[model samples]
Target: MAQRILIAEDNDRVAAFVEALLRHEGYTTERTADGIETLQRIGRSVPDLLLLDLRLPRLHGVDLLKKLRKSPVGNDLPVIIVTGVYRGERYARAAQSLGVRHYLEKPFSANALLAAVKDMLPSCVQVDAAPEEGEPFDRHLYQAFSTGFSGTFHFEGKRKATLSFIAGTPVSLRPGFRHRDFGDYLLQNGRISANEYDYYQGAGHFRSDVLVQLGCLRYPELLQEKLAYLTGELLEAFSGPPLKVEQRSFPLSPGLQLFTLNMPSLFHRGYWRSSAPDTANPFPEEVYGQFVAPAAAFYRHVNFLDLNEEERRFVSQLDGSRTMAACLEGASGITPLLRLLKTFGMLVFAHEPLSVEMPAGMPLRLLFNVLEDETGPGGDGPLESFSDLVNEESRDDEPLLPAEPPPVLPEIGDLSLRVRQVFEGMQGKNYYQIFAMEQGKFSFDQLKTHYFKLTREFGPETMMQLAGEEAGMVEDILATVTTAYNTLSDVIKKERYDELLGSEKVGLGQKGDDIFQAQVQFQSGKVFLDMEEWDNAEKALQDACNIAPKNGDYLAHLAWSIYRNPQHGSSPAMREKVRQTLNRALTLDRVPSAYAFKGWILLEGGQDLLAEAEFSKALKLDARNNLARKGLREITEKREQEKKGLFRRMFS
Candidate 1:
């Protein structure tokens, strides 16, 4: 049966083009001009894949996607995002989070669309094709078994395989039963001559070990390459005829070396290769020289060891800035090597450098129009120019005004008095009220929008005219809003806040007590600290300390807050005050926060040894103190790096 695809596009031309292409490729295609009709069709029957356009009538594409993901059928269904206007990182990230695996801007080729469809939906035997031993090898089964299970899979007859896994990801796959040894495997792949393999076999040692002993290979790198080769072979076997598979699990021995393969990327690369053995490079000719290898492939994976002499040199020459064009210039047999490397998920084609020099005094609207016009249907030019515009404006000393002036905020009558009133009654206000949100209904995006507006309207710098008591009140309001945003913006914090709100609603009001008020202020300060609003955190913490003068915990937190404040004057003065405050807190009680803050102060002053000691003391008092643990880890890593440097110098 032919697979079905639903294309949701507003443009009639694009929809017709896509539908014709899919039908030509032996697929049944459905078309809709907007999100509402698409959703209605999907509600009646889910398509095998969804080809969705971002700009749609009745509902936006992203909004429709979010709604689709909530439905039972949409969870695992594939979606290919087709967009023209929506070329922002925020949109891309959102789509990815919603499980959009493929993205194609408007004017995408039929071949590109077909490749994406095949990749997302690999043609395999149905799930019901379990051959008497284990379930069929579908992506779900692959992911499920690989994620956390360690086992040997005994295939039919003389064929069997052993796989080790850590946390549902394949660490390594070792062949079993009728599988060839490393020497034979190497010879079969033409990595070694027949004579070389025979000679290594005669040495009475494993091929890799013998190669290392003879200085023919680096053991670490050669081992990684062997594993990758074996893994690729195993995956190829899985795509063959159905066989009985018996799985057995056993405890993994400690201290064994494991190779971590990004299964998802690896599988995708393998599938693409399988589907299009002779396919040309998907990247444009303009980017041939600009392609760069993923840095993670070097630092994180052992696969970097698999590079041959020329491949190694080529990779080493890629210093992020050097394009493939520049690096592979005049190199022999480079195109084939580049193609092979890309096929194995080793390369990210091109990093477009942003243009910094825009026409001076360009109006924001004209600038946007210029970018949109240049970008065209493919949207590449606009995306790059917009990024460049942002980069240039950020580095510019002068502020560029928007196309239109922002709405003027209503002037505060008796600003000081109003601020003082809000501060006094702040305990009665909830996070929702601070942002002027309707109770019980608001999204994170809504909260963020309102929070920024509130900051601009009543932020500290905007209150330069207010002084004395009024200035202090303005600062307090800023802190309160900052606290609200800090809590409401985070999922965990927001959930906890909602739970607390529910609890408070069911119980008697507790705003009457002084200690409770102080606790609330302290919590608000902690929120600010977490949000990295240093000045606001310091002010709020100081107020908390003032409310409870003898509270050692309050004093210790206040000291740390003051230490982190950039505007707290000279470093020397700040350090001295932090030390004195910590000492006073320690005198009152041996709290871990005091010790941790002391460690921070010591660390900042280049006293690592002393800082380590302070952190140790804090850990002794409270083992769960993260600051103490983090401080110790930093000191240890620094010492290790220093020792490594010393050894390198001595050897040189």
Candidate 2:
């Protein structure tokens, strides 16, 4: 039972940003683009908090707040004003007068927005109260389908159906539509006469089976009719009057027996067949913003929708060149179809005002100053310090490519003289330390927020804006944060870090450091190598390489392990994979093991001359290397046999 939040903003980007941030924290959210719609949603059901934008289309921010205060439904609702339109002292005073204490200007940091939200809505007000049967049916149905909800959902009220799902996938469901019984189905389709149906109806439970015995219904046709009847029931349940739903975990709760039902098809056909509004929220206000198709990878995930030829054509035309309105012209069922696309995340309406690519980040520095002045002493009443909105550049950072692992971070206060002050603060810190979090204290979502907070503050534009900071120094900070994020964000890598942090065997100065952690993994991989556990060795060694890619020894062992892994069958693809890894190892440094492995691959491929050359290189690097020596021995033996055959043929 998550606490719900309403985002009332006309700007799609801003609303989307706020919605994502809140939902990540386990809050249910709804977005409205105008004052009238916002009030309409509130009158139906009030959210725990309202993130109101100042310049709403149908109603102004002040007017909306004024109406809210007088309304019986939302009078005491908490609010945080998020906007770029209103920022002057007069607006601040006007809002303050109306008891709006939390105000965030546009382009505010995620921290600023979240902090304001957290302060006003201190506790998550969970609503476990099931809606009056008809309500939340559509909402829960969409949620269940989209999220792959697992368990039994008992739908009651006007109709009844029990649905059973495994691992969030529906497998069993009894159709609630009982309008047409088998007899009615048979009579309507002219399979049996009216009098025959009446006689068959009296035959009771196994009427269809009874008909098969008699000449009234053929077996194949009967099967088809039965399927049609049951499928009709399923569709009727989905498309007809809303039902009250009771959810219980599967196996523990009484469930309908397993049925071979294609839930996705049922959902798609049911959703479209029924007249329920295809979307849960108001349509996007970005009219001029052209409609865009979702990327292929994203679309593939929901390809279960299995669009027909017409739907596919409609989607193909949404190539970011034409507005949705323009597409609507002469288009039939485009509204529901478009809404369906958006609801399922198959389309992106990067509307007008702001493109889909970015959020409007207004500076928060000015608002903070304004608030500070307004809060001076007794003037502003019960507020003192408040959230500062983040102002960052609209562009995203380039994908971080793996580079040579940096040096192990030193302990703080034991500083580096050459490093800039900004870089110095983080030089000795772990990922958790960078975000001011204690180990294991935060969720992954919280980790993302922390990572986002640092990245936003140190973004290119913001970093350059800082007095005396150079590009190289900014790069240093960004790299450290990015590396820390990469480690602590991954489950396997994070576990290794935690294990490394806890171990007492670490070097005196290198404890809790990234480079030292890589050393730990490399040693672990070497132990796996001793046992000939190639799979385990590859994983551990790969992790080491990830942490310290420049270490030739680590890379060489990883390549050898990959080559020897039993799971990878000896094929051209496998050989190439091994060689690519060895190439990386050799590029880092001329480790004898790397050359020896390369020689083995060449020998396996019958490239005898090339194998000999590689073996020579290995021997030059390390004469005692057993793999290289063995390879040379095998090559000499083959040549001696060839010489013997030639001499024998000549003498005869």
Candidate 3:
């Protein structure tokens, strides 16, 4: 048997990468995202080695290791501690007493990890791996879980269902079976006698809750049974005609998660079991021209076990230019690898990354800083940095400023004459002029390269040195350089800037004043939408509509904003007005949003049939509209429920 290695790490990304590395080395791996699950897994089946992270939920790693040291099974288990915690040497010393033989710091490479595991499990067996990607549905799922990833698995064609995974174990599933309630589940599975179920039904206060409260069944045990039953159902449905399967990496939120059966083990419990499909290239030739990007959560949990030598080489060379063709020169197996990566959703296939609209939109600099603040070192939660900013501003009595005020006064004579000349004259120049480049001439790649070079040569530290002071002046100029890059790099922002610059050159009159005003308001509304400030969005989009009443896009956006704003009560009057606005928008232009929002209104009014029709119309207009697609899904689910209920009534 292949030696099984168990990874106890709360960081999903780190855990996944480690698992992938181990799997490639021919070791079977199981992962737990928290201390509680790790203990349970160890109790159920002992692994050959334990790769542990110190910071874990439910139980701390040092304490858990101490507990394990006292256990018969874990007393002499080979252990390695891998974590990013600062000053973790203190923990290392404590773990050493408990027989943990090795400690690897965060950001360690694959080779180092492989070496450590190999030293501990010298006799581990290796097997030739089956094809891992772009396969039929069942094997794709098996490979995903076996690699120790946790997230939502989506099957987007016939027999669609979305299933949630926690550390390679099935936890929850959506689009649940028809007419399946706790009572039906219990009775059908013979968990409870019919008499017992009838008795519980007579008393009638949530059957499961009552059973637990009365000590007739333990909550944990009951939940486990429930999850097992659901998992069985999901696996059975996995045979739905060769559909497209996509897996996404989800960050495990802080909590004590309930136990779930590992998918591989669950498959062995008699669900549809099958081998992986034949390996033939599924990607089109044009796929090479598309850019591939890592998903948002991929940084934390990346898997490269499936890639071959050539694929590995090509992937390592990805320089943010996702165009596969650009990097595929002389590379073999690159096309199949790209298809696999795209199928697994490890990388996003896009023509280009979407750019933020100008005006009212926060520049990419602020956006990235916000992202870093949330996901960066020591960051605790989503929008953590932005929340801190809001809290700080709320506590202070000062007005919110256009820009962050300088840190403190610094000396001006600190810089050399050349640095001083660059700083003093930087603000007056246009972005292109500041970059010393001509507009419509330089490519984005060229602009990015130039920006990097300039920042490196004349960075903020360089300016501070030249100024001979710690004043915020140098930082201010650095900010300008950053702003210029932001304006020049984004496709939409750069295009708008070019248009404005060209207009200025020709001295165009205010012939399109209304159009300009409407655009400004529309952009503002979009920014509000991005921020989830529905009230502000409504106000801004309302202004846009007022400025250009005939623009169906503006009116449709305004209608959506109004519908989303909680301040506007969902009274009959409000609903009627929203409907009227949507109708007007459709009359002006038959865009998908007008029909989609009209469906939303009708759906809210309990007109399911009408709403379904409207949604269908929207999908006809724009098949890829997610709003319309979701609306149709909801209606279909409701219809399924009614059909199930009718069947139950006739049968029962």
Best by lDDT: 2
List model 2 lDDT by residue over 1-652, tens digit each: 3466888987777787777677666566767777876887687556789999866655666678888888877677888887674455555655666667777888899999888888888643535755444643445555666655678888876446686666555544553344335676566445666667777767645357777776765454355455556555565454344567888864433353343344444555655544333233235666434655343323333334445434444543444545666545444544445545555565565554212222234222212111222232235542222212223331124322236664565322111222455566775566789877889595777777877666655553233223333444555566557667878878898988887667564454664577887888899998998899988899899889766766778888887888778787534345444655676567558899888888997777555656888999999989999999999999888767744553333233
Lowest summed lDDT over 10 consecutive residues: which window, candidate 2? 365-374
Worst 10 residues of 1 by lDDT: 365-374
In candidate 2 the C-alpha lDDT for residue 28 amounts to 61
What candidate 3 gets wrong by more than 4 Å, as runs, is 86-90, 123-652
- Candidate 3 residue-wise lDDT, 95-170, digit = tens: 5667766778888888888888888875333346442233455565666565666788886643356767776666
- In TM-score terms, which candidate is top? 3
The TM-score between candidate 2 and the true structure equals 0.28
Candidate 1's TM-score? 0.24
Compute the lDDT of residue 154 as modeled in candidate 3.
Answer: 82
Supply the global lDDT for candidate 1: 0.60
Cα lDDT of candidate 3 equals 0.60
Q: What C-alpha lDDT values do all the predictions have? A: 0.60, 0.62, 0.60
Give candidate 3's total backbone clashes.
Answer: 10
